[model samples]
Target: MTDPQIERKLIEIMRIINESDRPVGARIIADELRNRGYNLGERAVRYHLRILDERGFTEKHGYTGRSITLKGKEELEEALIGDRLDFVITRIEDLIYRTDYDPVKKQGNVIVNVSYVDKDDFEKTAGLMRSAIDYSISPRVGIFEEDSEDIFVPTGKVGIATVCSITFDGILLRHGIPVKPNFGGILSVENNEPVVFKDLISYRGTSIDPIKIFLMRQSTSVTGLLQSGFGTILANMRSIPQSAVENASLLFQQLHESDIGGLLAMDNESGNVLGAPVDVGMSGIVVSVGVNALAVVEEYGIDVTTRPVSTIMDYGTMKPL
Candidate 1:
């Protein structure tokens, strides 16, 4: 068995490599370790990498350095399972704290969901995406060509970064209004209108984002909704203090004026929004899911991989799609 301290250092090294856009060398790994308060130098880092390579946890490129292998990812997940409880909610809070987008000024960084699509299918994907944009969290998107550093775009695939609905939560939090993300669910639509939630997975109880679950199950019909005005679409439910409801409404309006509208409904009283209940002191709010378009592309038989609530990016850099 590995020493507990050494095991922790290994996990951190693998995590850093896993999150990198490209293969990382010992120098970069050592620098990252130092930033995280690890005192290991490049030589020590290389020793650890050799151990990882021997264990088949990582693979090395000629001179590009190392990348985590499939086994490595699985091992990391298994080792960190205990620490990932309520991780989705924790990540939301972190992203909210990091979000600094100013809608009034129309600048700053906002949380985004990144998706990768084959370059050949990008045009069709974009058209399909446009069909579902009005139903998406935001109408703006950032496109990254292959080999771009802004975000990982696998070779031959383009990356699309869509504005996440959580940006609303972040903006509200920045203005002193606490927002509580409750669940991700499917909203039934009829005649171009939202009816009720068909399913919900609470963020606090799940390790993974519920939206990703729904997407994986191909549970959304956003394209169907666009074509026939009757289908189930992905959405999220949140709660906020009733006293902050009024202020939240103003902020949401400003968000719309700035062209980031995703607000589907907000309850006036401590009741419910679109049939999802809220606590006594809280008000229910619902918004469209940001990756709804990606689901549509998937439904159309175009393969796409998504990283929901992935990271933050400059809002001004995104373009209308």
Candidate 2:
């Protein structure tokens, strides 16, 4: 006799029926149960099936067999709610899980920026950088379609510290040595191509340093706009006010003597840069870096405290010796 309190027999019966690709005979189910150490008899198995059918959990498909109905599958799923993630990664094992499309092909992509003096170092750094991106973005369970293009509108600065890992690889690999063009911030997107918010500042070789930039918004009312798409978020943030422009100038002036390693635009209130900064070559290059940085800040509904700065100096902008 099966232990009535454990409900083990009933669970086993459901498991077997659910596993079969087609309806299974009651005798087959009972035999499987007995083989698994449950001493349920044929009559007991049939009785359980009738009860399950009455509860809309299973349905008799023909005179001799029964199959799990949609309702039955739902009950099993409900009972297995804690295993949802496991089920998805194991059963479907697709890259992108979407309510509307194939999970495999549509899997979100990630972008990593690595800075190295030599090509060999860049390749090595890429592996570590890729791992960082995977660990940071993958475990956010249920987040799909993240690519370089997905614009994350931060509700607050609370999580910004956690996201800094995206830039750690480049910084650590270079022993804190600044890149030539410096790192042009890194952008990871979900479900689309990454949008270039600003033109990169470059001199000689390819961009070696990369910074990951994100937009911040306080208006919860704008959350829906961000969800519509990245372009919408970019457009909305780009519409910041002129008052922010004046603030950007003040911030830049204050940093004149500070190491000011890298500059980020900030809103007077929240102190967060809402858009990407244009690469300004260096201290006193052309005014475009600061100007473009301010423009980007205003465009993203943010005020700038200082103009953007790069560690590298473009020879083209330097005076003749």
- On lDDT, the candidate that comes out on top is 1
RMSD of each: 5.9, 22.8
lDDT (tens digit, per residue) of candidate 2 on 141-224:
111111211121123211010111111112212232222222232222223333333333222132111121222222111222
TM-score of 2: 0.24
On the 0 to 100 scale, the lDDT of residue 76 in model 2 is: 74
Can you write out model 1's per-residue Cα lDDT over 52-148, one digit (the tens) per residue?
Answer: 9999999999899999999999999898577567557876787788899887887898889888898999999999999888888778899998656
Relative to the true structure, how large is the alpha-carbon lDDT of every model?
A: 0.86, 0.33
The runs of at least 3 residues in candidate 2 whose Cα sits more than 4 Å from the true structure, single-residue gaps closed, are 1-6, 80-321
